[model samples]
Target chain A: MRATLMYGAGDVRVETVPDPVLRAPTDAIVRTMRACVCGSDLHPYRSMHPSATGRPVGHELVAVVEEVGPEVRTVRVGDLVVVPFAYADNTCAFCREGLQTSCPHGGFYGNHEVGGLQAELARIPFADGSLAVVPDVDPASASDALLHSLLALSDVYLTGYHAAHVGAVGPRTTVAVVGDGAVGLSAVLASRRMGAERIILMGRHTDRTDLGRRWGATDVVAERGGEGVERVLELTGGEGAHVVLEAVGHMPAYEQSFGIVRPGGVISRVGVPQYESAPVGFGSLFGKNARLAGGPAPVRAYQDGAIADVLAGAIDPGLVFDTVLSLDDAAEAYRLMDSRASLKVSLRP
Target chain B: MRATLMYGAGDVRVETVPDPVLRAPTDAIVRTMRACVCGSDLHPYRSMHPSATGRPVGHELVAVVEEVGPEVRTVRVGDLVVVPFAYADNTCAFCREGLQTSCPHGGFYGNHEVGGLQAELARIPFADGSLAVVPDVDPASASDALLHSLLALSDVYLTGYHAAHVGAVGPRTTVAVVGDGAVGLSAVLASRRMGAERIILMGRHTDRTDLGRRWGATDVVAERGGEGVERVLELTGGEGAHVVLEAVGHMPAYEQSFGIVRPGGVISRVGVPQYESAPVGFGSLFGKNARLAGGPAPVRAYQDGAIADVLAGAIDPGLVFDTVLSLDDAAEAYRLMDSRASLKVSLRP
Candidate 1:
């Protein structure tokens, strides 16, 4: 089986690996149909030190259940499935509360336990709780666009939805989406679905922000830092946005979020924050009585609805995938995403 | 007239000052009946540097309107009123949204424009938007208990309510209060009012924690640092509290909040955070998908309901004021609160 592996910064490769087997009664072996690059993966791509043994890499995947352990009841062989990045039993107290990411028995793929989900075949733990079987959608006959959208459900799209949902976006909300990455663009679409009437996309990339505008962003601020904050304030009648979706985890993006969030607004960070400490005192969130929310998207909780929306053609989040390549080209996918040459790249196995 | 002044850390005094005059159409001259020392005041009492010209101090006040400028419509001369600590023209967009503390034209009483309300007579700006007139109480004959509760409404009580409200305490909530100050205890009371099923008060002072327990803290953890976090986790079946009310502004209090919050929980800080930055990265809030909320209480927004509850005898937040002193003893009031000899001290002018 071919698997995506990373040896060091700016280094990713597709190499032959032993096939995964059912390890637990709750496990399933998934034959990858589609997998994609995530913005978070770039964090390691830019700074991870070189290693001799290498590390398992990709997480987003729309796969088919090739085999299942006896206890795996929700998904079975030959069924198309959208597997969330984080695996949870869906019965733990935390999972019941929709915080599956923090479930004690939950874990993410791309780690040694489950293996990188981008491989031809990968072990899935807690299969019954983690993956949603696509009803009536045949993997072999599904359109590439539908497959890409389902693959997005595995992470990015729902992550964007998580930002808007946690931020409490509503018809009265004026949303500001920081970072025009695939997640940010998806947030614009999400805020729109949640009924936000105004959305400002803060990004310097004209091409990417154009899509954000098309999706639902009424305004685009191409500035960064103080200037970007000023632009967003200008767009929202000098009061700033009611909800600021911070899709870029860098300090600058966070600074812009606190700067342009309304006095009682929420700043939701879906992008994995790059650094630890930041101002949360009178100089930032406290002064404004603002809220800071969002983290790893509880994708498993939203999977059922997202797949329905995708299948119903009510949403087209797959447009975020600007490029596609064979699984053997995972290296190129990583490179293209890192260099900003592609909004997002989905790989077919 | 005499006003309370802070010359520096550990140096507060009651000194003669010129009588206040109505400064604007929105201003009202208030004859201070009760003004209290707050935990936040202790922040500067411990750090403010000495100066020849001291800063005017106290903010919380229940007073009678001595005189009102032409445009002060909501309050009338000789009317008893509970003036919120931060004065605001409630008609503004921020005020209308119930975020009066962020109202652009609003300012606290101790600032240069208003003089200290812990004086014989103080000027209140935005009288119509900043004060809630007592429906039937006469300042000249009001009971000490009633006056004390109304004074609490100016800041501490509502500050506590703000923490619980922003934390979204509900019937199913398990709350952990991280400070035993007046505001933290107030938060316990507020959480109970909001229907929280479990309330854990974290503090070392038995007297203070006793008051917290009376105010609806179902459990008390006297341990500090890691042990406090451990005790709180134990109380909540190892998952931590659903809402951690941070009533102390120090980093340690903030640290305790993140430590004891359950995944998908909220950590609301009502204390004026003394420091600027803290970890919001993967190791803290982000990892648990926790939320960080709260700031200065928008007392003006919750005035009506809080006042009604106090008057209705449904809550006794006035118990926070364990000591009382004459206006001439402002210096002593500050000392008692600073040394923890008094949970809170109200001054009668």
Candidate 2:
């Protein structure tokens, strides 16, 4: 099987690799129909994160079950499914609490124990809990756009929804989305679905801002950092945003998200912050009485509803995929994404 | 009129000053029947906070309305009242949202525009919103303890209650209180009132721990910093506390409060963090899905109910006041509090 592997920073390649096989009783093997690049992937791609020698590159996927282990009961051969980015047992107390991202037995695919999905086939552990069967869509009939939404359900879409949901966005709320990447744009869509009265996208690029507008951003602040927060406050009657979605996993974006939220408002951050310890402005948080909530999206927890929204045409999350290519072109896809020329890239296996 | 004036740090004197007269249309002159030294006051008294030249030092008080401006409608002359430490206009949007402390028209009584209650008489602005009538208590029959409770309601007691309430404590929730001061002790009481099943008080002193136990702390962690968070997590089955009340205003205490709370848990911080840009580990908060809330307590918003609880003997918040002294001993009271020899000090006017 062909798999996308990274040898070092900016060194992505598609090479022949052994096909995945069941190694645990709860594991299942799946033939990947679609896979995609995630913003988090860019962290290591840019060498901002420690580079792993010969690392397999993607996590988001929509596939058909090719084989199942003895303990796998819900999924079987020929079943089409959406696999969440994180693997969970589904029976742990944390999983029961809809916090699958922090499940005691959970682990992320493409990192640690599980292998990446940018390949011909992949191994999925805790299959019963990690795989969600797609009800009616035939594998061959699924369009790149629809397949892209299915792939998004693995991480980005659900992550954006988690950011919006945890932030308590509602009809009376005004949301400021920091980061114009796929997840941030998805947050705009999620906030809209959650009935936010206004959605502001903070992005620097015209193309990303245009995509954000299509995804339900009612306003856009093209400024970055402190100036962006100031603009958001100005747009929101100087009260700041009622809810802020921080999708960029960097210090400046995190600080901007915190600064622009109003008193008693919430900053829901989905960005995977890379720092060990960043100085938090406690005085600002204390004085404003604001709240901060986020984490790895509990994608499995919202799989049903989010997929339904995608199927119902209430949202076209597929718009986040600006570039679509064959799995063999994964290296170029990584390059395009790193160059900031594409919002997201989808790969067909 | 006599006032407790601080000429500089470590120099407090009870000296004659001009009598407070109505300075605003909504102001009222109150003759303080009783006042108390607060943990916050010690900040300036110990030179932790810069002292302003010729500042009057007390904000917690139970007083008799000596005079009222012609525009004062809610409070009348000769009425006994509890004056909230903060003065706010009841009609501001922030006040309407129950965030009286952040009201656009609000100001801290002692730190800002007016002389505080350590004086024989003090001027209170926004009288309609800042003064709560003592509906059922007879001033003559009230014990020193009861008067302390009224004074506590002006700030500390209500501040503690707000912390627990904002943290969303209730049955089935495990609460961890970080701080051993009067406000933290009051939070133990407040958490109990809110029906928290397991209350853990984090402190070091045996005396304070005993008081916490009496006030409904089911468990106590005497360790400080990271060790304290570890103890809380160990006690909570390794999941961390569901709600944390951060009552101490310091970096270590704030970090411990953050570390001890579970993913999706709430940290209500009523502690006035003094530093301008205290380091906040947003990644930890983001990864855990935790929430941080609270500022100055909206005392004026909760004073009536707090007073009711005190009068009904449902709570003895005055137990926090371990020292009582004459108005002439104001300097000594400040010194005792600064030296940590007293948890709180009540001054008789």
lDDT of 2 by residue, A1-349 (tens): 9998877778888989878888999999999998988999988887834365588878889999999999999888888899998889988988999998788888787743578888899999899999988888888788877888888898888899999998889999999999989999889989988898899999889898898887789998998777887888889888899899989878788778878988888888888886645534455566777877777888999998878888898788888888899999998899899999888999987
Model 1: residues with Cα > 4 Å off, grouped in runs: none
Q: Write the per-residue lDDT of candidate 2 for residues B229-290, one digit (tens) a residue.
A: 78898999999999999898877887798789898788888877755454344455766677
lDDT per residue, candidate 1, A27-70, as tens digits? 99888899988999999999999988789988889999888999
Worst 10 residues of 1 chain A by lDDT: A110-119
Candidate No. with top TM-score: 1
